[model samples]
Target: MTDSTAPRVAIVTGASGGIGRAVAERLAADGVRVVAHYSGNADAAAEVVAAITAGEGEAIAVGGDVADEAAMAALFDAAEQRFGGVDVLVHTAGIMPLGPIAELDLETFDRIQRVNVRGTFVVDQLAARRMRSGGAIINFSTSVTRLQMPTYGAYAASKGAVEAMTLILARELRGRDITVNAVAPGPTATPLFFAGKPQEVVDRIASLNPMERLGTPEDIAEVAAFLAGPGRWVNGQVLYANGGAA
Candidate 1:
């Protein structure tokens, strides 16, 4: 049962699946009322809401394209109307369009940046504007920013922008008690990458990490939940939850 006076109200973008879905569920389980934002997957989002409520967590699914500024604004408006002001914002809405730079078309590159970078900025800006004093904002980055893998140039560039934004925002919100942080997870076993890849390629990618295993959505969610909840002293840090991988 949620207290009518609960202070933590979170908006989680790209919440239909993967890390977004996991974080939304985890935060709700932590007693934070969550707004699960998804672009088009209503069924999946409903499933997420069901899972959370079934687990005794409070959550609702909201649909909007994170890349659309108007839609994003509306998402926050709805969340605030339903659950009060936003207290935490988790930006997990991003695309990992991987391909060699030489082969990457402009359309693909722009699309990735649009969703990953621009969308992150939009939501983070909104969070800063409306977050209660001492709230948290968690952005999603990738270990590729450190590994600098060959085929991930464009994708890494987007996450790099996220890292820079998070750092600046942390400093900007220094006196407000709003800790800004990012999570850089290595090869996660999500349909985001594994579903379409060849078996051998997937194995090779997972084995690249020191852990010799793929990261799970739940693994990253655990770290994100910590940062969103109790890790106030851990400000301006990109918790690289890649299991010893770069």
Candidate 2:
């Protein structure tokens, strides 16, 4: 069991930008020491660390491809070495390639599965093995799994695997006292979501939700913070943070 008095520590993958960055900042603000993981953007990762430090929160930038098991092992090592132990893991690292299922090549499909599904399994397996009791494991999924949008077939399939793993892992953890859950965010205003999308298309998608606006990274971060903190009872569930778009 973790010492409740000690400051909690978290490793947030994909912390270079978007929802991951927001979640890292929010958890740091809540007195958790953050290991901000990034894949390619060292400069952006440093900026996130700087932001956390500027706010008088503790954070460090760690770079590694999410799908690489060795790199991920090192990431967990850095967290344990620096913060004593890991209390939470928020895996927001993934790739989303929007293409019609009919035309999506096998290569593209494999790449998505490798990064999204395999990466989650690698990270969560490590977390499950290493996290102390009273820990939380949060995985990222997409609201599109529920939305069932046409071009989202491949991406949604990857997330469906994530949802499946999340539920089973929660049960597998039985006596560990760790909560496992997936957060499925709707169209958030992130660079990834905006890429290759026209303003008109963005507007139309935003209007599908009753809230009538794209969810912000900070909006998703708030939900993540809840799960990693006081949401111990919310295990084995997928929380759709979609603003009712589906």
Candidate 3:
């Protein structure tokens, strides 16, 4: 339901690195005015905006915690002040830590839930209120929801909640012509994925997928681009863009 002829103003949260950065760059390249939202990395966020502006694409970096209302308010305000009303909201902010459920501390679990689950809710609620009638909202989930890998219980549970809320929110936006969807990626070769892993271990993990290599942030961003731009009929669907690995 996007106004395809008009410029789509998008707010990409957690855009400082990894999938988020890739999505912001791709959307800007596709002529979508982008607001690259980062939690604390102003430098990284500035770099993204600089790249876009250098290419004559419209972009700005807005710092805020996605789970905080005051911060999100400022984020939305900045988007309107910089461009206009938001037309696309892409929530790519998430975290995954490896620990068996038995060893997972309650504090760590709560923190992860707060960001992964509560942050999505916060962003979606704000986006639902701010986006144009024909806008689209994209949320992130992990293929672990389907794979059920060990040490992913808390993360998957949070995303499972995301899936539920996304569906219900679509119903709430019924006549608005807006669409809400989630993208669940498999093992991707972002910096987060490679961090602290031995090279041999990383290679072994990469080869497990049928693609014979780890997914690139660019690859996930392509799917995000489709959902954010031309993927109108993809309403309320959780698109698994994991190279058929799921």
Candidates in order, TM-scores: namely 0.95, 0.99, 0.96
Cα misplacement distance, residue 130 of candidate 2 (Å): 0.2
Tell me, by lDDT, which candidate is best: 2
Model 3 TM-score, 2 decimals? 0.96
C-alpha positional error of residue 152 in candidate 3 after TM-score superposition, expressed in Å: 1.4
Q: Which stretches of candidate 3 lie over 4 Å from their true place?
A: 1-5
Give all candidate RMSDs, comma-separated: 2.3, 0.7, 1.5
Residue-level lDDT of model 1, residues 1-246, one tens digit each, is 334466589999989978899999889988988999999899999999999989988888999888787899999998889987788898888888789999999999999999998899989988888788878899999998998889899999999999999999999986787899999988898998786689999888888877899999999999999998888789998989887877
- For candidate 3, lDDT tens digit of each residue in 10-57? 999999988999999999999999999999899999999999989899
RMSD of 1: 2.3
Which residue pairs of candidate 3 clash? none
Candidate 1 displacement at residue 115 in angstroms: 0.7
Cα lDDT for residue 159, candidate 3: 92
Local accuracy by lDDT, each model: 0.89, 0.96, 0.89
